[model samples]
Target: MTGRAATRRPGLARVGATLARAWRAVSWYVKEVVGENDYEHYVAHLRRHHPEARPVSRREFERAKLDRMASDPGARCC
Candidate 1:
C-alpha cells in the first residue's frame, strides 16, 4: 500500500467503470439502430394494447415481419 499503487488502483477502477458504461451505451444504441429491440417493443405494445392476448414468439414475429418486408422491399432501406 504505497501511495502510487493505491492511486493507480482507484484510477484503473474508474477507467474500467467508464468503459463498462460506454460499452453498454454502445450496445443499446446498436440494438436500437438495428431494430434488435423490436420484439421487446412488440411484446410491450401487445401487453399495453391487448392485455388479453398473448404475444407471439420472437421467431414467429421475425418471420412474419420478414414475410411482410419481402412483399414490399421498397418500404425498407436499400
Candidate 2:
C-alpha cells in the first residue's frame, strides 16, 4: 500500500473513536435527564448510609418516587 493510504486509516480510526466517545457521553446525559440513573443512585445511598436496610426494587422505587412527587405540590416546575 502507498504512504497516503496508510495515513488515511489512522485518521479514520481517530474519527471513529471520537464518535464513539461522543455517543456514549450523549447517551449518559439522556439517561441522567430522564431519571434513569435514580435507581443506581438510590442503591449507592442505601449502601453508604443504611447498609442494614433493604433497598426496594427499581419498579417500587419509581412507583414511590412518583407517588411522593404527585402528593407534594412543590415538586413541580410550574
Candidate 3:
C-alpha cells in the first residue's frame, strides 16, 4: 500500500468508530425516552402540543416516518 493510503486509514477508522458510538448513544436515548409499545403515547403527546396538527392514520404515519428517516438520517420523531 502507498504511504498516503496508510496515513488515511487511521482517520477513516476513527470516523467509523465515532459513528458507531453515536449510533449506540442514540439507541440508548431512544430506549430510555420511548421504550417499545409507546407509539400511541408519543402520537398523543404530539397532538396535545400541536392541537392544530391534523391526525394521520397509523399506516400513513408509519410510512411517512420511514420515508423521513430514509431521506434525513438526522430527523427526529415528532
Candidate 4:
C-alpha cells in the first residue's frame, strides 16, 4: 500500500464508529440488568396513572425500595 491507498482513513473512522456503538449497547445492557432505568419508568408511570402526584427523586426512590425490601422481617436478607 502506498500514496492514496496508505493515506485512506475511512477504515479508522469505521472502527471508531463501531466502538462507539458497541459502548452504547453495552452500557444500555448493564443499566437494564441493574435496574438503573427504574426511576425513569417510575416517573413515566406516575405521569400516566397519577398525574396529580409528584415524582420522587432517585435517592428517595432507592431508599423507599430498600425500606420495602427490609420490611419482610422474617425473610432472608440479600
The best candidate in terms of lDDT? 2
lDDT per residue, candidate 4, 1-78, as tens digits?
A: 577776677887889999999999999999988878889999999999999999999999999978976887565556
Sort order, TM-score high to low? 1, 2, 4, 3
Clashes within 3 Å, all models in order: 0, 0, 0, 0
Per-candidate TM-scores read 0.86, 0.83, 0.44, 0.71
Local lDDT at 60 for model 3: 77
TM-score of 2: 0.83
lDDT string, candidate 2, 1-78, tens digits = 799899899999999999999999999999999999999999999999999999999999999989988889695697
State which candidate, 1 or 2, has the greater lDDT. Answer: 2
Off by over 4 Å in 3: 36-78
Q: How far is 47's C-alpha from truth in model 1 (Å)?
A: 1.6
lDDT ranking, best first: 2, 1, 4, 3
Where model 4 places Cα greater than 4 Å from the true spot, the runs are 1-7, 72-78
List of clashing residue pairs for candidate 3 = none
Model 3: per-residue lDDT, tens digit, 1-78?
699999999999999999999999988788767643345756788799988877687777777767877989764665
Clashing pairs in 4: none
Pairwise TM-score winner, candidates 1 and 4 = 1
Worst 10 residues of 1 by lDDT: 69-78
List residue ranges in candidate 2 displaced over 4 A: none
